[model samples]
Target: MKIAILGTRGIPNYYGGFEQFAEFFSVYLAEKGHDVYCYNSHNHKYQEKTFHGVNLIHKHDPEYKFGTFGQFIYDFNCIMDSRKRNFDIILQLGYTSNSVWFFLMPKKSINIINMDGLEWKRSKYSKPVQQFLKLAEWLAAKSGDYLVSDSLGIKKFLLEKYKKESTYIAYGAYPFNSPNEDILKEYQVEKENFNMIMARFEPENNLDMVLEGVALNSEDKTPILVVGNHNTKYGEYLKNKFKPHENIRFMGGIYNLQHLNNLRYYSKLYFHGHSVGGTNPSLLEAMASQALIAAHNNDFNKGVLKENAFYFSNPTEVKNLLNNSKKSNNLPFIKNNYEAIVNEFNWTKINGDYLQLFEQCMERYKAGKSK
Candidate 1:
């Protein structure tokens, strides 16, 4: 099968979840004898024409100069180029910026869109922008040959809200067993002596609430390390607000996966505050590392963690958990989460599922054409 993956910054992921998914999924498909091509931004540092046996196609991405509006241009370029490639299938990771171009997608390629979280519900967007996103979501739903939901909750949401049926395929994570204790020394932190929160500092992610909870418990000698890109306006706001708390450390964006996994593996607690997305990669990584989790209480997080992890909604709830928290009490839950990753969320299983879905889409497309 000739497959084209779009709607991401591209492989050799220096970015977030979608890029990581592209990297892993493309490589996996390529290894299984499928011809896979991934679209990359021209600005991407990796200039290689091929990465891990998957073809890389670089296109103009004006996001650097034009800001948010530039993404639509990039997506247009990709879609227009994909029309000529005559791909068997096109897997679009998200529809926020590119859904408007669904009409331009090649008729030959079966479009399978992974409808991500409720983007219109994000607090960061204005009411008008939110309405536009709702329109985009509708366009994407109507245009795609097939739809994919990363969470069962999201699948249910599409059914109720849009009367759209979608395949439920959650994100994948690899278990982390080996930990480099020396990496902790580099960060000036001891093993199991710190609580951690690693996520983009966004309003919807609830970073402010996590910081507030940590600040209120500053008397605890064990520090709470916050890891992510802290250069954004929201990040700076949280930094300034929590500047007085010595125990709350802001370790800005560490991309080193080994070191990051070691930090998660050794942490006394891992706080996942993502309220919108389904099966967040970071949350899965924390679970894979067997970290004691205190996640934001929502259907999305609840669907993944179930009754095996701690839940919190506000700063007070976070504070209460922190006050009563113990590593020993969370041991069973941590073990259960690790097993869940191996059994349900492992990349091998996820990759296989995607391949099967692709085959099913191809068969259905052929059958429809014959009819």
Candidate 2:
């Protein structure tokens, strides 16, 4: 089968979650003898023509110059190109900018959209922007031939709100095997002596509240490194607000998976504050890395973690968890999470599931056309 992947910054995963999955999934499909094309921004650092047997389609992305609006131009370019490619399926990773171009998508191919978190509920966007995102979500749900929900919570929400039934395919993770404990030395922390957060500096991610908890518990004084790009306005705000707390170290975005996994493995507690819908790739990676997770209290996190994680809805809860966390209590949760990664969220399983879904889409699409 010939497939085209749109809606990411292209593979080798220099960026974030979608690109990471696209890199892994596309390479897997290519190895399985399927023709795969992953679209990359023209400005993406890895400008090669192909990556690991998968075809690379480079399109002009103006996001650097025009900000968020530039993503629309990039998606438009990808959509226009797909019209000529004769792909069997087009897997759009998200609908933020691409849903508007649903009309232009190739009619012969089946469209499968991975409905990411509920963007409209994010606190960063204004009311008007939120409304626009809702409209985009509705458009994507209505126009897509198939839809994928990464979490059961999101799947339930889609059914309830849009009456759209989607396949529930959560993100995948690989167990962190090569743990270089020395990586902790480079980050200026001892094993199990530091706490960490590996999310973007967004309001909805509950970063401020998490940091507040770390600050309130000053007696422990274990460094809680915040890993992400902190150049944004919100990042600066966080830095300023938490400046007095010496324990909160803002370690700007560390892309190397080996380094990140090592950090998570050695950390005393890993905080996942993403309140967005669906399963988060970082949360999965933290599990695979055997981190003792204290996640934001939400249906999505609870659904995945179940009894394997500590839950927190506010700074007070975060404080309580941090103040009393012990090695004995954390070990079993870490072990169970690692097993979950190997058995449930493994990349091998994820690749197979996505391939099966694509094949099913083809069968259903052809049958509909014949009728």
Error of 2 at 253 (Å): 2.0
Instruction: Determine which window of 10 residues in candidate 1 has minimal summed lDDT.
Output: 213-222
Give Cα-based local distance difference scores for all models.
0.91, 0.92
Tens digits of per-residue lDDT for model 2, 136-202 = 9999999998999999999999999999999998899988878888788789999989999988889
> Residue by residue across 70-169, what tens digits does model 1's lDDT show?
9999999999999999999999999999999988999989999999889998987889999999999999998988999999889999899889999999
> Which portions of model 1 miss their true places by more than 4 Å?
none
Q: How accurate is candidate 1 locally (lDDT)?
A: 0.91
Per-candidate clashes come to 0, 0
Candidate 2 has what TM-score?
0.96
C-alpha RMSD between model 2 and the true structure: 1.5
